[model samples]
Target: MYILHRTNARPPLDIKDAEKSDTVHFINSRSKRQRINEKFDAAKSRIERHQKRWTEIGKELPPQINRRHISVISIGGVIGTGLYIGTATALIHAGPVGTLIGYMITGTIVWSVVISIGEIVAFLPNVGGPVGLAGLYVDPALGFALGWNAWYNWTIILPTELSAAAILFNGFFPNKHEDFIRQSNIVAITTMIFFAIVINCFGSRAYGEAEFFFSCFKILTIIALIIAGIAIDLGGGKEGFIGIKNWKTPGPFVEFRASGALGNFLGVWSSMNQAVFAFFGTEVPGVAAGEVQNPARNIPRAINRVWIRITLFYVLAVFVAGLLVPSNNPDLRGSASAGSPAS
Candidate 1:
């Protein structure tokens, strides 16, 4: 509990008697500042009380977790359900060039944020992360505001992620009974959530081991996709050589908003939100800086590598997708199936 001091009540100073009452004027001015400070402290303490429960969750999280775990999480967490299929939407609205332009711009922005936060987290690698930093270095109001925003945002994201995983899985068996899929979805989400909680309960070392293997799997999967995409583009499959043919037929750029070159640029800009979604989790390292082994070494390293990895895995993958699939494809418009773009 924070103790707030209240100053004694005083009357307002009159300018007419200013020369005669310097002490009274000074006392009134100082008391006014103290009252303002007391009010601010009260608000700050109230916010911190609400935030205390969230910080307690980190108390059980051990600090032995190393660079490998944090690094992979930083890279892997960003690759979400959006990357798996929603990118198809971007391709449709914006053609290949537009999509590329949007991703590059968004990627640069993400990179800037990652680096800026990395520098701060490296300097003060505390457990509370952005939540703590906002109050400590910046204003408490900013911290309180951002903390609630993040809490609200992430709370919504969790269930959506579960449903998304189920949806992507259901895409595999298009002929399966909907009732069975619905039942299985309930089972899958429950099981996954349970396992995630169990892993987290085991503390950071357990998490490090688990995430290490998962990251390896994710990296390998992306590599495989890129390779397969290239193969498909170069006439690897029985479909014959694609070789930028789709790009030429539909034309590289699509006019989206108004007209001329400006519309085309806007078309590219339109996918910025989707690109932002795709590049969301690149800052896991900064968030988990307190638990990581070496803040200075690991955080900066992750920041540097994350951008390149994202470009290679995401940007290049989108490029390959554009080359292999046409922007005007009906699947992008949801005419093909309701489940997933891949399906």
Candidate 2:
């Protein structure tokens, strides 16, 4: 016999009795269907919650840059030491015409690559730049390699820039001792690096401002150089416009060994390599897409201008240098020994 407990609440029923009982039973036939439905509903809700969380996790980051800054910064980053120094070597290897042709070819290739990058960057501007794109469009491994390689390359470039700055300063102050110059250069570079880090730490606004001014200065400098070069070529002070006859006289292609077509081809290839290196930083603008203010507007504008800028700055500069100093000139041939005026 089962004794029923007397209380305000109803007493629990035995499993067999509850199944057979019809009074307010939660596990009855209809209740069983409700329980299954409830379970299904709960499982569906949990799956939805998980999916929502994943969507949040996978959301893209906001852009940090503006349009103007990106356009100018890209120009600044690309028109550095490579264009200034490396072009001379290319001009030496392949005469003016050969160098020009090589630049045209390489410039086209680089322009195509930049345009492709622009399309992707405009769609999804992000900080990781090309590496991020590669990961998304290509593979993770490739992205990792490209990212680290780029980081390493920039790391090495910093020290080299510092060294170059020191050399330039020493030229201005010839009286400075070698050891003193070296130490001073290290101190200066360290200070600049520290300041840059501080500015960057503040945020993107500061960086954008700094880049804007720096790029402006670079642009002005280039403009001045172009003007000065044009004046010099036209015989501004000493000589009068030296016309295009020099190009015709030398007949553009200069063979190192004078071995004919094959030799000339090899020489041109060597020069092409140098020219390609000179244009290495042309894609730096795309890297700035994340920071650009109006990426869609400025990125395409910047990318579109790359070929023109490269041709004008690099190819035109080389052409001028060739005109001012013939390819056969000792300076052009890079044969100036130690203490040589060209050196």
Candidate 3:
């Protein structure tokens, strides 16, 4: 029993020795850690104070979209009346070859723009997208300017889209009186606005779902149109194996005002506006990075798909349209009442 007691006994410690013990050291370290944490929190708060109010509020809403949603948004956000109707104007101005060349040039530009936007969005994932990117990395004043500029653009675009839809809706009744067309346009605009409000009110998830559905539909429709145009060219219609007849007859390029290569070059240049218009919304995927899951992975994937969308949707469609119609067609001139040049 005496041996056991001796073995269990601990050595005595002096004041200095006790201060260096594990328990005391742990206590001191814990207090130091607390101070460090407090300083860190203070610095974080100070930094956050400089952030935009929207950036703070944006974080409160968790990401609600996935890779597929982002891809669809990027792919379809800009596929609209511009491609369907505006291409006609391009064809009228620049003939088949000129229009095709203009679109190809614009496609390259669009690809570069989307790539740049995707890189920035993946790195930063800002709420204001390009606007926020400018503020954080470039200059806050630049961001502010871009924000208001974007606001002005969207404000103009919203009403213009509604007006375009109204005009297209009026196209169904070509023989209708002017008053009837005007009234129909009013009704179409109101109905579209109501649907837009309802869809947006359902939140991002609903918007994503709706966009996906429409994107798929548009994809199928464009594909069908292209196939039909090809078939008609290859003797699938009464025209019977049109081949490159239109191209040969009208020649490859049209002059804008002059009668030679200069006119053709000018025609191609003028068509650039419509080509650029066709790609207006291609950057939406970057804009949507804040609302998408795993933006680092998904945004780049979506950006990679931009070229595919441009080639299949815009380039091929333009090529097929050029094949199907002569640039000098009177219908391609388009009257005030003509809603669609293709139609």
lDDT, each prediction: 0.74, 0.66, 0.79
Best candidate, lDDT: 3
- RMSD per prediction, one decimal? 7.3, 15.8, 14.9
**At residue 259, what lDDT does model 3 achieve?**
77
Candidate 2 yields a Cα-based lDDT of 0.66
Estimate the overall C-alpha local distance difference test score of candidate 1.
0.74
Structure candidate 2, residue pairs in collision: 65-291, 65-292, 65-293, 66-292, 66-293, 67-293, 67-294, 235-239
**C-alpha TM-scores of all predictions:** 0.77, 0.70, 0.81
- Compare the candidates by TM-score and give the number of the best one: 3
Candidate 3 — which pairs collide? Answer: 235-241
Q: Which has the higher TM-score value, candidate number 1 or candidate number 3?
A: 3
Ranking by lDDT: 3, 1, 2
